[model samples]
Target: MPTRPLTCTQCQPKLLAYVHNQLADSDRRRVARHLNDCPVCYAAYLAQREVAQELAGTIPSIGLPDSLQLNRMWLAIQSDMNRPRTIPRPQLARMGVACLVFVLALLLPWSLDKQQVALAVPPPPRAPVVTASLNVTASPESGRRALPPTAAASSTEAVIPAAKTPDTPSNVQDTR
Candidate 1:
C-alpha cells in the first residue's frame, strides 16, 4: 500500500538522520520516497548531505600524539590545573580601592546626618547659671550691664575682638 505524501515540515526533521543512515529502515524508506517525489524536500536533503560531507572532509581526525609527548603534555596540563590561581597585584589593588570607595559611599551619608543632628540640636540649653552670669551684671553706670572683665576676657570675646576703625581712636568717648 502507498503511504500518504509527507509535508516538508514532516520530512525536514528526519533528513539529518536519513543522511547519516541513523534512521530505522521503515522511516528511511519513507523519507527516501518523499525526497524522490518532492523537489523542495529533495533540494533540502541534498544541501544537508553536502554540508555533512564537507564537514566530514574538512575536520581533521584527532589521533593521540606519541606516548611520551602526550604524557608530557598531560603532565604540563595537570601541573597547570593544580597550581593555585591568584589575582594580579594591580587588580587586587584596584579591588581594594573599590571596596574602600564603596565603604565610604555607604558611610558618608550617615556621618553627614550625624553632623546635621549635632547642628540641629540646640546645645543643652546653655546651663541657666552660665546664661544668667553672661546676661546679668552688677555694673549700673552703663544702663546696659557688662559681663565681669574676667568672664568677658575668657569667653569668645577673647577669640574674636571687635574691629576698631583707624579713624575711631581707642580714647573716643561713648556717646550712648
Candidate 2:
C-alpha cells in the first residue's frame, strides 16, 4: 500500500538531514517522494541544499598547533595582559589641554564680571553740540531772498527741538 504523502511542515525539518544524507533510508525516501510531488517542499529542499553545499565548500578547516607551542603563546599573552600600561606623552598632553579648557570654561563668566565692573564708570558730562552748520546764503542764479541768520537758526532749532520736553511739537515749515 502507498504511504500518505508528507506535508510541507513534515518535509521542512528533514530537508537539512536529507541534503546531508543523514536521514534514515525510509525517511529519505518519503521526503524525496514528497519533494517530487510538492512544489513548495521541493523549492525549500533545493534552497536548503544550496545553502548547505555553499557553506560546506566555503568554510576552511582549522587545525591546531602542537600543545607545547600553544602553551608558550598563551603564557606570552598572559604576561602582556599582566603588565601595567603607561600613558603615552601625546595622550597625556591631550588630556592636559582638555582639562585646561574645562577650567577656563568654568572660570570665564566670573572673570568677565570683574572686567565689566572696571568698565562701568559713568561717561563725562558735556554740553550738547550740533554737528551740522547751517548756511543761509541764497543761490546767486535763483535770485531768491534768503532768511536772516537769526531766523534761519530759530527755524533750524525748531526743526530739531531739545529732547527734554517730548510733547512739544516743532513749528518748522517746508520752504522748498
Off by over 4 Å in 2: 62-176
Tens digits of per-residue lDDT for model 2, 51-113: 977876787343536789889999999999999888568978999999999999999876765
Q: What is the lDDT for 73 in model 2?
A: 99
Give the backbone clash total of model 2.
0
**What is the TM-score (0 to 1) of candidate 1?**
0.35
Models 1 onward score TM values of 0.35, 0.35
Q: In candidate 1, what are the lDDT values of residues 1-176, reduced to their tens digit?
A: 87777788999999999999999988888889889999999999999999989987887354535788889999999999999877578978999999999999998876664334334433332222222133445667877766654433232211222234554346533221
Prediction 2 global C-alpha lDDT: 0.72
lDDT of 1: 0.72
List clashing residue pairs in candidate 1.
none
lDDT (Cα atoms) of all candidates against the true structure:
0.72, 0.72
